[model samples]
Target chain A: MTAGVTARTYMIVGAEPEWWYRDLVSCLQATFGTVLARAGVDPLSVLGAGWRFLHLPGDVRSEEFYYPCPADESGQIDLGSALAPHHQLHSRWWQPADENDVWREVRETLADNRLVIAAVDNFHLPFRPAYGDVHAAHLVVVYGLDETRGVVYVSDAMPPAFRGAVPIEEFLRSWGSANPSDVQDAFFSDSQIGRRCLDVRLDAPPAPLTPELLGSYLRTDVEAFTTATSTRTGLAGFDAFAAELVERCRAGDADALRELYPFGWGMQAQASLHGELLRRCGRQWNDPALAGAGRAVEAVAHAWTGLRFTGAHGLEDPRAAAADIAHHATVLRGKYARAVDAVGTTAARL
Target chain B: MTGIAMSSVKAGLCDPVDISGHRNNTAISAATETKAGAFNVWGNSFAAEYLPAGGSLVHVDGVPFEFPPVCDGPDNIRAAGQFIGVTPGRYDWIHVLAASERRCEDTIELSFADGSVDAEPLRISDFWAAPAWFGEVKAFESLVMHYPHHVQRGVPAMMWAQRVPVTRRAELTGILMPRNVALHVFAVTLQRHGQLA
Candidate 1:
């Protein structure tokens, strides 16, 4: 330990962070769910409330937890806002203020009784299935840092769900790894785990999701989708993105397919959650149209599987894969348009 | 019930179509030779020990299926729009032993002898530690997942017994698989329209 570093432990007062997960979501949503659960919030209700499509070309990162994050006017990226636009949820990425004392920030965050979302390479975490086999960047919730015991309390909800203590040395290696390229995992590798962590806070308790409240949120999201912005967003933005992706593949650019897998996951997971939430609300309120709209959104999520896997298997031959890529993209675009229409009609009634 | 009454209500009236000719993907592997199977882009496979033996007849939910060859060679059709011919007979259902790299929903074209074609939905859940989202019967499950380099525990590989309806009361001639590369079909069976007879 350093000179002023105390050989002590810090942890939250309540129970361990709950593991919240859906089959279609990635670690990005899973870790965020754990934090929200600790804050006395239903993970799905908030995470599944607002949904929109935003694809940033040349801005995709090779990480399992990568999501399209846009910076505000002051150049500060708030991932919480991007993920949950309907609520007062806010998040900002931070690193250790002192390179020499890397645990300083983690200790302070734990002491404040809040969870820390740490970025790490699965290759180094023993609990991860990719440990010593593949290199992929992922996220996990950190609930405790027992420097005295030389173990960090970690919780992950992704497949092969794991929670418990990890040795400090191994956690450090994973958290600070330079996740290099691996042939086995073409999509979620080649990204650096630069000890990045997300500090998320829900400033206000989410309002009970009544029909009126949900209708307003849906109207706002529907507007975002119908309106064209400077950035790649909404229905028009999706058209622009899909066209360029097919063009790049046809031109024999392999990088285009490489970026599609990670980028599509965020959009897919969002649609699935949003769809599930709508279906639940619909069933409770005896509104078949709302439930059907949820199913339409889910079809959008399902359609992404074809496009993503086609691009993945076609990585070896981009030109040859262009036809199938275009076919799936067209199919996905149709699903998106249909889903938007359904949600719009349902929203007006609500 | 009389003998005649018992004989009239017969079950197991399904023909297991031989799809050996269309097997193009090796998705099952023994723990010792995990490198041979490449089910997904990550080169993962189902553990052979936990699955039915090679070339066995397995019954799932009253439907019989001829299990594909296990460690010998490719055990599933990695759906690439292959067309499988069936005996021109009236059928009520098309049962399949299927799994996908992820939760997938696609369409399959059913061709009839009368030259009519219909597209039916083929939904399969993810094989990697995921539930059957489309309410498919869990036909077979490998307790462990076989990676190219090692056998991973706690992550089960699942194969679903899903069926598509042959709603058209016509003699089915052929079935056209989807162009999706993520969907895999191990075995298929055509159940005769016994109730109609």
Candidate 2:
């Protein structure tokens, strides 16, 4: 490091990053939504275009943005591909190259006029309701870095949304926090922030969503759900996941319930967005069948509340909660089946 | 939050049901005793200051409700298959002031005195700074959320007014709340059959 070298300042030119959010989504989708919106694309059209159920064993993390992203044979995972199966969006996780200059990657990304999705700890961020009270791993978009002013510009679209400069010291603490486990937040704590950041790119602008295009998308998703694979995906995968979850709960394994909260959140959020998009499309096109199918899919999302919350409250007694857990799992599975059938039938006609 | 008023309904068509025996959860707390409320798993609750007085009569869209006792003790009933028996009557709508740990859509069993039972949808939106996703009327809100240790500002808690239809023409004798632990019912009112209640 050269002595007396002035630190560079960078900020994405244009309006502040827009806060794109839905009630059901976590920070993962919210941050991605903001980035996609900045690229002149409707966040929902991209994020909600495809939906599938995938659960990788031991892949769940105690982070709000945790979503299962399987790696290829080459050991590389593309979160963007996992999120938008039908789009040219891609993302990669990266960390600061030099520990001495923790803000290097952020500066470079901001200089390139790209927004960075950085992992953070809620306990350290003043704007967070959990600030200094609870430790929870979360994600937020970083739009600018001002070394000269000693503040880092940040934006979060979640509840009590905040956008503005944060003291560099505070931001760093949150970004690099160990995020020790707090009893208050069993689902999102105990995960390390590790100064991680997600670099997202929309390789191509999405085409207008025509009826035919949506039909094709629905058909593909329907096929994915109906076709059975060795992976934990689709109806068969959900069956396996649910059975195993119930078994573990019966065995009094609390970890099963813990994982269920975060893992179910990802699935729940996806179902909600997909259903909302389909319903909107249906209404706009005046297609009652499609709208009905969307409602079915939304029922799957709503059913998740029962299962996830049951598991959440049952963390204290997995064995006692097993029956209720199994009940909700069965209910949710039925919803998935019905929604899949409805979507398939509607897609066939579309 | 104001409700959409339905015209042409009789002035005294609503009857506030007594659910005092079913109050099993404390969801509201004064700023001084935030720890007393545990609305969600996180021990968060609604601030008493922003709510109607305990045991007060509150109205939304001309539907009267006997708001449960606040801060004093259990103020809401966490749904767990509790069978709430009502006066046998031919009601058009069963209105409830409810909230859920998250946006939930479950079913409640409506038992008629004619020995027939029907399952009706009971949908409630998340109370954690969320919108009324189920098209429920926003009945009450705590401007600030109360955590066990402190009063958290900027995050508000919500209570919704949602209803389930008594589709059957027979008298409704009892309502079996779903076994779902996510739902919480604070108050209930029965609107007589007629005029868009």
Candidate 3:
């Protein structure tokens, strides 16, 4: 061991990631939003411009950041492409190349002036509410590292928004946590952190959004919803998914409810952002019908709350919760139908 | 906080209602025993330190309200379709101290003496370190969130003052809460539309 050698310190060159937050989004969107904002792009325009209903059955993970990333044409999973189907958002998960010296990749990333989005366990992070208690899988941003001071500069846009340094030992533990099963948080626990980090890149700047441009996106999404596919997608796909969910609940399958929370979050957040963007555009463009359609879509987002929470609270006895689950699912289906109809009409005019 | 108060509270415009009987959820916890609270599925709660004395007459923007108990049992009403009978009178607004598991928008039925029922939108923002998305008044904020096992700093738990419009001119009978499991009501005050209201 080189005891007398100075410890290396690396940090992104004068970059303070902005906090891009919404009540409905998880850490995945928030971290990506921050990175996108820092790259001089509006997060909503990229992440919320287009929306589709895709429920990859048996693919939902027990993590707050779980979003269905369908296999690409080349057989590789690219989450960024899935999240922003209309934009050039590229992301891929990676780990430390050198197992013995894990900070090497981070230093190189920092040297290249890039922020790292790292998966972490909430139990070891001092800022998390679950610190020293539950072990839920979460994500945070790492912008700097100082080996000499033994601290890593991190930022988390989640509740109690934090932007400060954490001890290297504590940060490493959280980053590399096994994230074992915890009864406290059924949806976000049981996923290993594995010191995983996401390398995000915005390949190109988004085109200026206009009524005609947004109308095209809306038409595309509406077509996606209406058309049938081999994968779980669109209105027909949603009906099948909801029917199976209700059937599973009636059969007392707890796994169905367990999967609902994380899966529903992605859909809810997408609707929320898309609706917000539409509303903002409608007002700016003085289009009353578009604004009303935006509100309808937001209602769809709000409707997810009822279904998701009902499924969450009913985890103990799925059979007993079937009626309520079925009721909420029916209500949500109605909302999606109405919202799609409204957005479809509005898009046609635009 | 100041901006939140502007949208939520109407000074000298509200009459505090008797809502203690409707309290069914305990959302505030003492530092010593944080496990007593079960506000959400995860058992997170607001800290008692940053709140008012239990059952005190507190005012947000001059609107008086009967603050619920602190570290006491059942400080808020976890909405479950409970019908709250109100004094028969005409009111313009129904101010409520509330929060939600997430951002929620639902309807609360207002019953009138004419056998009429009107459902008004009841929108509340998330209490978990969130901004006022629904333009609610920030009534009280617990600087630190209380978990079942520990008191967590930096994650502030918020209480909001939101309102529902009572458009009917007829005599109000009772209010029917929504069947949503995510919404919680801490206190309610009816604002009389008249000069003495």
lDDT of candidate 1 at residue A13, scale 0 to 100: 70
Report every candidate's CA lDDT: 0.92, 0.92, 0.88
Task: Considering only chain B, report the TM-score of model 3.
Answer: 0.92
The C-alpha RMSD of each candidate to the native structure, in angstroms, is 2.8, 2.8, 3.8
Residue A346, candidate 2: C-alpha displacement in angstroms:
0.9
Candidate 2 docking quality: incorrect, acceptable, medium or high: medium
- Residues A123-239, candidate 1: write the lDDT tens digits: 999998899999999999998888888999899999799989999999999999999999988888899899999999999999899999999999999999999999899999999
lDDT for each residue of candidate 2 in A31-64, tens digit (9 for 90 to 100): 9999999999999999998989999999999999
Candidate 1 chain A lDDT trough over 10 residues, lowest sum: A1-10
**Arrange candidates by DockQ, highest first: which order?**
1, 2, 3
Query: Candidate 3 docking: what grade?
Result: medium
Interface RMSD value for candidate 1, one decimal?
A: 0.7
Candidate 2 chain A least-lDDT 10 residues: A1-10
TM-scores, each model vs. reference: 0.97, 0.97, 0.92
DockQ of the two-chain complex in candidate 1: 0.78
Residue B179 lDDT in candidate 3: 78
